[model samples]
Target: TLYAVGDWGQGKGKTWTRAGGVKLAKNGNAYTGTTTMTKGQAITARLIKVDANGKTTWDEIGDVKATADKTKTVDLKWTNAVEDTVDITINAAADLKTGETLYAVGDWGQGKGKTWTRAGGVKLARYGNAYTGTTKVGKGNAITFRLIKVDANGKTTWDSAKDRKSKADKTKALGVSWTSGKVNEDGTIPDDSAISISGKGVADGKLSIQKGNLAELYVIGTQDATPSDAVWWSDGAAVAVSGTGTVYGVQTGTAKVNVKVGNQTATITITITIK
Candidate 1:
């Protein structure tokens, strides 16, 4: 019998029977039969021999590799199954520009005998806000990555200042959001400073609230010795705020609130989850 595992259904790992008793091939070896897979989707499977009384005798573990076509076939065969663990990894893709390229360097690559250039760097494919790719690395390996953009005239731009860092493991899915747009020509990173509301109930940069719930928007930066005039605005019709920065949630949806303190302006995102 073959069993599928790892995010097959929902929420982390899940197991499902992929095949019953394996079919006997012409060479007498048992095969689990072909399993169809998509281009970017990955799946890990384990083969188990079951006795008549419903007990597993032997097991062999393996993973399916994605192909270039829209679909791929996977079949598992083992003459002598053994008990062991096999780690399967599917690298994530990022949403980025068309002309730009993503690269990863650190203990996972450089320390492992790879350079930090376009030829030696680990390249990631653009997948709509994510750059996805696959690499084999031991657990707990530290990694850092950067982006390079080359123009039509052969000029190149590098976003080396804001390299993202993470550890290599199943628990850590590496991802970074280019919320402030791409890197500039001079290599200076863009500022992503914005106003945020923090208090009793808030998570993931979003302020969750019910209808008629009162929330406060806090200024994130240090104020000057002299006070400046502050103005506040809300994009959603259901959201309203007083002059003192107290916000009231009137309906369910997302509300983008903007605050201007003298020459500086910042926006806060609020989500009205319960009406």
Candidate 2:
């Protein structure tokens, strides 16, 4: 409906007018009409949308100038914008290793579409079994994002969903996934890049052990449930992974192995003292 909003001599008030009504679309889907309540004066146009059952869906107002049969287009702007944020969680795929990196990309955070600055760096922190990120969108708009993994060798792995190339861009968020591996609930370490020189270091990214008989290098990872997938990696032949991180310490005296259980990196350098 149209209303004349001006000094009507009665303390400047607005009243109903029969000059015109907002016209609906041809198929009765949208509003597109004009009014001539008061020529050369400002007209206050109020449009109300209702459902088939007469339930009010939307109600907005717009001010337009009507001058001597001139139909000025009314651009209605809704003041009640959506102000809720969305929480997106990714239960990262398995096969993740310690010392590697997992990042979120494609516009999930303030990074424009990235969750971090570099591919080898992780910004979205992982908790329990999920990597959580956040974003805000309009009522009918969808959010987009994808997962990225940077391995020990600096190789990247994108989200392996739907051709493994498309970012998750949708309005619905409801799903589950598996973890990189499994963590010992009793693992003594508290953060990434940590190793256990027979349970000595916690959150420290480095440690050492002895030769032959000191053959075991156990990594009791973070206090949180992290994947113990860091390979039994080492430098040259200073030590060999006996399918269970067994050290030889016979042929070589120095070795360094890089691994991680979360975002940080841990390097285990063994300074073997020959027996």
Candidate 3:
């Protein structure tokens, strides 16, 4: 329900209330109105009483402007407007290139939440409901994502990722709000829910696979465990990856060994220190 009248110039206006205690104001070049009522009170404006069922509803009444004569009063009558909530969905894939915007939609009762997309993604959420945030991959050595939410007034907020148990745990926790796109208020990209590419490298700066001069691959993380059972590959003859982390190269030339982990791949160089 929208109305327009007069030559509503540009960028400069005042807001006020008028008629039937209908607080009105000129937002830039349009007339806006609001009411004061308890919950369950249907909003009545322009001969229409819109109900607020915990959802965002909106309808334009009409537009009015201040006459050049400086003698104009635009007043409207209706129900009050309260904050509502709605569900949103977002789906994004890894390896995303720039300029890819995430689509967001909500049931803004009336017709608000039209449609919006940000190339880098936007953060949104209800105060006590859920805190969520989103961002695109930026230029950084290691970048992490998290979801955050704020109140209707755009103040007071929370972050779901900050309270995550673990990277894997965050994945499961954030998958709930996962419609096709709307991720949970928590920032969690799981190996299964999301895509990932894991790569392996030998800091020794030598081709351990190519030379086949090595026995097998070991994952001596921060701990000094002889982690056996790791996959051992014969060679990259058929792009075969070591099931665990061990390999039996064919003592070949310089070859780069690699393994796949979900959406990521790991690679290692074998110099084949052939004696």
How do all models score by TM-score? 0.32, 0.26, 0.21
Cα lDDT computed for each candidate against the true fold: 0.46, 0.40, 0.30
- The full ranking of all candidates by lDDT, starting with the best, is 1, 2, 3
- Residue pairs with colliding backbones in model 1 are 92-132, 93-130, 93-131, 93-132, 94-129, 94-130, 94-131, 95-128, 95-129, 95-130
lDDT of 3 by residue, 22-105 (tens): 433434344454333343322223322224453323335443222332211223333322212212222222221233222222
Q: Give lDDT for model 2.
A: 0.40
- Lowest lDDT block of 10, candidate 3: 164-173
RMSD, one per candidate, in order:
18.0, 27.0, 27.4
Top candidate when judged by TM-score against the true structure: 1
TM-score: which is higher, 1 or 2? 1
Ranking by TM-score: 1, 2, 3
Q: Which stretches of candidate 1 lie over 4 Å from their true place?
A: 3-47, 50-57, 60-99, 104-114, 129-134, 152-155, 177-275
Looking at model 3, residue 196 earns an lDDT score of: 21
Candidate 1 local Cα displacement, residue 248, angstroms:
37
Tens digit per residue, CA lDDT, model 2, 1-275: 32222232222354533233444442123233333444445444444454667564334334333233332233343442222442333334334688666665554333344443353233444543344333343333333445566788988776655311112222222222232232221222233444333222212444445554334344444332112343455765665443234444545466676445445555567665655
Q: Model 3 off-target regions past 4 Å?
A: 1-201, 209-213, 218-241
